[model samples]
Target: MSSSIPVSTLRRFHRSTLHPRNTSRTMATKVERSPAGEGADFRPPWFYTVARVLSWTLIPATGFYGVFIYDFGDHEHVFQPARRWAERQKAAFLTLSAEEKKIVGNETASTKP
Candidate 1:
């Protein structure tokens, strides 16, 4: 499970690769200059600006529309059907338990103090 490479091996590889044959020549980076006046100022294209605006605007607009649809546009309207269904389910369970109690007939005494 050892993940480390030997330090000696790394040092050897670094020395072989970095030490060039001509020690007199130092590695100075060469700069290639651009022509005259092109690429001095940068301005984005028209469609790019439009795309960025649309992306930002559409994202929030979609979120607002989604919320609006959930709130007032859908058939049930703001989780009302869900609430009513839950209440009906609870009532049904209570009625079924009451029938079971009538059938079972008092097996245990009340434990409340």
Candidate 2:
């Protein structure tokens, strides 16, 4: 079987699927002045502008304070339980006999393999 189409068939398919170019004069027209043309010169109220500037300034200031200056000590209460549990674990490990610690180390190594 020939896997070829005639050039005339391709041209006919393209012509049938192609959209017509826009010909309306309104599509090319530009408005001289809009109904709300007075708003073109509008500026936000003084307080609104001030608030916007303050918000933008505070956003970065707050981020910088949190990252570099904020005392994490003030929030330690939130992690107190986890911190206490870790301290207890460390103390318990410290109290273990040297032989017990060696056994733990050996067990840990064997578990990995």
Candidate 3:
């Protein structure tokens, strides 16, 4: 190694070392956002994942409530003893007149031969 220094290069370095710096302006700043560099208007991949999970969870829950919890299956009706009795009473009240019964009996007698 050599320990020699040049005179002209030393003077140029001394001149630049004393220069002033600007302190009036500052660097720009912005709000924090997603890693994809999208602003508030952007929808991330995580949102899609959460929405899919929510939809999948809710669909089965809705079906369960509709099928069991809400008792939509019980909306259909079946005839019981009371209904049968009422229907029998209605038929009895609407029975054929005596003249109609006589005519039916005459027809049966004629058809037997």
Candidate 4:
């Protein structure tokens, strides 16, 4: 009974299931290179300059200050002063009447030295 099956039919079914149809979507496009890497010498944008300066100077300075001073003690002790300051600020802001809020808002945009 096994000999009744055709070998060619089994081979055709196995080949179709094992191999997928090739398509143009599977092909990769070639990249064109600039001669002597001329295009690679382009200057970074203005923000890139700002980011470089901050990364090289401001960020490190801020980190040093935070670790050495702002977070000098345990969580409760170190953050107590900042928490009190924030509470005072909130209380002062809340105590301000409508006119005071308006005045404070205006002064924020003022060019006073």
Highest TM-score among the candidates is held by which one?
3
lDDT of 3 by residue, 1-113 (tens): 55467867777766555334322221111223334455433665699799999999999998655544453343453434445576688898889779989999999999996
Q: What C-alpha lDDT do the candidate models reach, one value each? A: 0.61, 0.66, 0.62, 0.65
Q: Of the candidates numbered 1 and 4, which has the greater lDDT value?
A: 4
How does model 4 score by TM-score?
A: 0.27
Error of 2 at 100 (Å): 54
Candidate 1, 1-113: lDDT as tens digits: 66498888878877755567524333211111334354332343587799999999999999756654345643666656665676798898777476588555544334333
Q: Rate residue 13 of model 4 by lDDT.
A: 72
lDDT of 4 by residue, 1-113 (tens): 56776999888877655456533333211112445454443444687798888899988898656744564555466556666787788888779888988998889869566
By summed lDDT, the worst window of 10 consecutive residues in model 4 runs over 23-32
TM-score of 3: 0.29
Q: Could you tell me the lDDT of residue 106 within candidate 4? A: 88
Q: What does candidate 2's lDDT look like per residue over 1-113, in tens digits?
A: 56499888878867654435433333223222434563232444597789999999999999766655555685665556666686788898779788998999999999995
Order of all candidates by TM-score, from best down to worst?
3, 4, 2, 1
Clashes of each: 0, 0, 0, 0
Comparison by TM-score, 2 against 3, better one: 3
Off by over 4 Å in 3: 1-41, 72-113
Check candidate 3 and list the clashing pairs. Answer: none
